[model samples]
Target: MGKTLVIDLEDVILEGDILDVGEKNFGIIYNISKEAEDELSLDYVSSDTKIELKERKYDACTFFFDLNKIWTSIEKEKLIKEISSYLKEFGEIFIWDINKERGKVFNNKIKVILPNEKIKEFTFRNLNVLLSSNIEEIKKILEKYFEIEETKAWEDVFFIKGKKIGTKVNEEEKIKYEGTDYSN
Candidate 1:
């Protein structure tokens, strides 16, 4: 079977109403917010793109841009659990987000021109979380279900790639994060 991949729709694929490199690749595009769902369509996206609404199984998933835009630490743990339920036993997950503190230093150098005011407004609110978010927390969440394969940072973006590591323990045990406080 072909590997299934899921991608965030906003900053990950569409940058200020313009399709980024991700739109050219095929996968199940997921819009966590209603506003994003309403704004995206095949009119602008590649014909290979398919918007996924229902919870479905996937082999690999990618979260580009920001995790804070999708969920909080506590909520993120829950989301990890939800993703685990649908992921194949040996599935992999990839995450890429702006390393807030580092990104700030080079923010001015990276400029993205929005197509219009509406798009500009949406992009601003959508990326607000990256300003104060710690990508390490997201890495911790993924560690519960997958083994860290690789982690690197380029300029301001931090990337993490993990492969599902099977354990003989119970599901709860497998998803538990020791010494990590997810209350935030």
Candidate 2:
């Protein structure tokens, strides 16, 4: 039986580059439904490391603050392995990246989970292309652990919060990401 995997991700994406290291706002939750499994449990083994950073902008004379910068890093391969291993025993896997905080500038960094698997050279365009065109490749890799349909999996991976909060599963929604271009 296939299980539904729900991933709640945070600033998991770095702007501009598309592919780079990603950080978690909190622990990723892998939720499976009753039709697939009765119970699910996961513990993040990575230690929490925090680093505080302050930056000042010229002209405007604005200062940036990151007081809760708990620096967290996990081996991309290891994270995938651990997650995949656990997912393999379930059904559909849902990956959700959410920007919990509302108004913090440069506050989204949740898409870095791929860097752990040696997947470099990422840009928003390519990532969106992969999401649309190369979904099978991603699905196969994901299938190694979970049972999810290619199309449906997209819903589980993307999230946005605003007046019109929703997933950017199409080309139009993805275009907005191009503005940043990973310089951050």
Candidate 3:
């Protein structure tokens, strides 16, 4: 059964479902323009690539400038799965990552101002592009847990928004994969 997870929910969330909105987290806590990246960099993830859930329900989540930083396709897929568990039924999710093709063009045009007060040409390569994928790949993974509603692009960045569908099929898959032990 190579088919992916399904978002079916019986005791799940719908548009009018009563969802408890927890203490909202504004994921973007830093303003890069107000600080130097070299002085205060915190984008690094630890050895565990797991996206742990908070002890509260959320109606919406966002991956503002961090999606591509996940270094592996498997890890990114895992992240999508983890996020799927964090939201209520019919919750919304938003993602923004730099487009691979357009990011190249955008990166090449970046000019850094030197300490000597002169601008020098530099190609930072999307500041560190790790998993730069197209819209198709994104839709494929998102469709596992959501019915993708919209997608848009702005220069080098792409955005996708979708609503959580259900969890019945996914729940069954989990149970199936976690079969009871039989030392056969």
* Candidate 3 accuracy as TM-score: 0.52
- Give the count of colliding residue pairs in each prediction: 0, 30, 6
**Which residue runs of candidate 3 sit more than 4 Å off their true CA positions?**
1-54, 101-131, 168-184
lDDT scores for all predictions?
0.48, 0.26, 0.52
Query: Worst lDDT window (10 residues) for model 3?
Result: 1-10
What local lDDT score does residue 162 receive in model 2, on the 0 to 100 scale?
12
- Candidate scoring better on TM-score of 2 and 3: 3
The whole-model C-alpha lDDT of candidate 1 against the native structure comes to 0.48
Candidate of highest lDDT: 3
User: Higher-lDDT candidate among 1 and 3?
Assistant: 3
TM-score of each: 0.49, 0.26, 0.52
Q: Write the candidate numbers in order of decreasing TM-score.
A: 3, 1, 2
* Ranking 2 against 3 by lDDT, winner: 3
RMSD of each: 14.4, 21.2, 15.0
Model 2 has how many clashing residue pairs?
30
